[model samples]
Target: MNARIAPPATVALQPDAIIRHARAVIATEAEAIGALEPRIGTDFVEACRLILNCHGRVVVTGMGKSGHVARKIAATLASTGTPSFYVHPGEASHGDLGMIMPQDIVLALSYSGETDEVLFILPTLKREGIPLIAITGKPGSSLARQADVHLDGSISCEACPLGLAPTTSTTAALVLGDALAIALLEARGFTSDDFARSHPAGSLGRRLLLRISDVMHTGDDVPRVAPDVGLTTALVEMTRKHLGMTAVVDADDRLLGVFTDGDLRRALDDVGVDLRGATVTELMTRGPKTIGPDKLAAEAAQLMEKHQIHALLVVDADQRVVGALNIHDLLRARVV
Candidate 1:
């Protein structure tokens, strides 16, 4: 029987050495990102133009680590006004090639530029007359040579100490993809509202698209009292509505003033003040800050924050109370 060989002894790094290695890794990645700055030239701009002029989706394809970067690029493009989706290069040869349309642009990534799965689909892409953009480390490789536009994603060296794993190269490619997407986004003049339309379920979209009218309490739900009403009657209205405040209005429902819980506390603490006979207008804050129903709910939140108040009256152009809301309403609507 052969003697069993003992395993090599493990060498544990010191705490300082581990920290130094981590800092070196970070610095290497930062240098990789910095190296991408000069490469964002005419080729990058041309890639943006190709994608912008495409009438169909930007079909991105890659293998292995490049595939992950390609997926992120596709998502970034789609969310930033550019229509894009990723297709696995290996699957493309297995009937996924039909997903690519004539008008669509193809973005292919291959670090070595010789990935068989990606190379196999080049003829089909070329025969179909689709514009191809290649992101590769090798400028003279078959993939780059066959592409209509080539983006060089070369790196000085892999951040991996052994120089085998894709570390710096992947970072450079990902940053390049971001550069292309942002350049296209700016060129298209994609506004915040346009982005909100694409992200309606997100908080930013809610902040931008949700109007004050959508969340305000209207009709009889609003806590409102006549200006001539007594403080006790206004407090009753505020309590019954559970909005923490009440609007003091005239007979025509035009806003005259606002009375809040803070005001109620002040009224109760005043020395020798006759709360029973005092009118709401006499104690309420006059010409209080108001917002239009057409304004965004986020604007209402800002107004509330600026004045350190919790409620706001939604008025029309004619300055009549159309609705009312408090901080609780904004919170419930997820607009704050």
Candidate 2:
């Protein structure tokens, strides 16, 4: 008699309740974001002006989902020329607050405006006289009242079925933070080059920062065989240079043609081998893929990848060979 009688069997959902719940959540949050555009006020402008003029870094902090948004905002600000870093509000009391200087601006985030971890640092912020920008749902909450500039992140209602979770509120807060960062970014006139400077470790950074001169093998290091040179010597030059190809140039260093490992293989595979009788002039390819010395290494990489070639002859404006480069060089220089 565990329950005195058997429990009623539950019916299967016709389509499924979970999908309906998820779609409703997305719809509500999308509407919340749509509402935020017209609500931006003078306080938002002031926040941007303050951050733009701050000589010190922007310190972003929050709790839970807001903390995740704070970290992204900090990254966006840093990449867009506004120096910034994220601090965990909970960790601030554990000595991480030392990262913040009095000169810095602190951006605090809370949903209901009563997040304990965020409020924990209010005393230190006040004692240091640090300027604060707050993002919260409730205007009258302690965190909002204490903030020098309070950004309204209120939403009509959360997407949760019970209207209890932080769905729509978090979306509004994140979008608002992005808007602030983008406004400051535009005001600062940040450029792609400036962004590359901040992100020097990635492939995109290499494309922006690398130039032809950085990866080219110049002067004597260039493997060049004279047009009149025998094919045997040309093969020796190609092998010694290790660039998978050798340039055929005249005494004036004007390019004649290029001979590669592929060319050598083709030459051997020929129906009739004319080794001793042939010269590099007859065996090499004339007018190969050539790049200017001042061109970006990224441009050279594009050309090579497009043609499926491994090397290029670096020439001056007059088309005279000044240097040479290969995909290997690009790989080593991180320009590929």
Each model's C-alpha lDDT?
Answer: 0.92, 0.89
Quote each prediction's TM-score. 0.94, 0.83
How accurate locally is residue 183 in candidate 1, as Cα lDDT from 0 to 100? 88
Off by over 4 Å in 2: 1-17, 218-221, 261-275, 317-320, 331-336
What TM-score number comes out for model 2? 0.83
- How big is the positional error of residue 198 in model 1, measured in Å on the Cα after superposition? 1.1
Off-target runs (Cα >4 Å) in candidate 1 are 1-13
lDDT, model 2, position 100: 97
Clashing pairs in 2: none
Task: Give me the overall lDDT of model 1.
Answer: 0.92
Task: Compose the digit string of candidate 1's lDDT tens values, residues 1-336.
Answer: 999999999998699988888898889989878887887888888888889889999999999999999999999999999999999999999999999999999999998999999999999998999999999999999999999899999888888899999988889889888988888899999999989989999999999999999999999999899988887898899999988889988889988889998888888899777887899988898888999999999999999999999889999998899999999989988997
Model 2, range 267-332, lDDT digits (tens) per residue? 888868697878888778877889998788999999998999989989887778899999988999
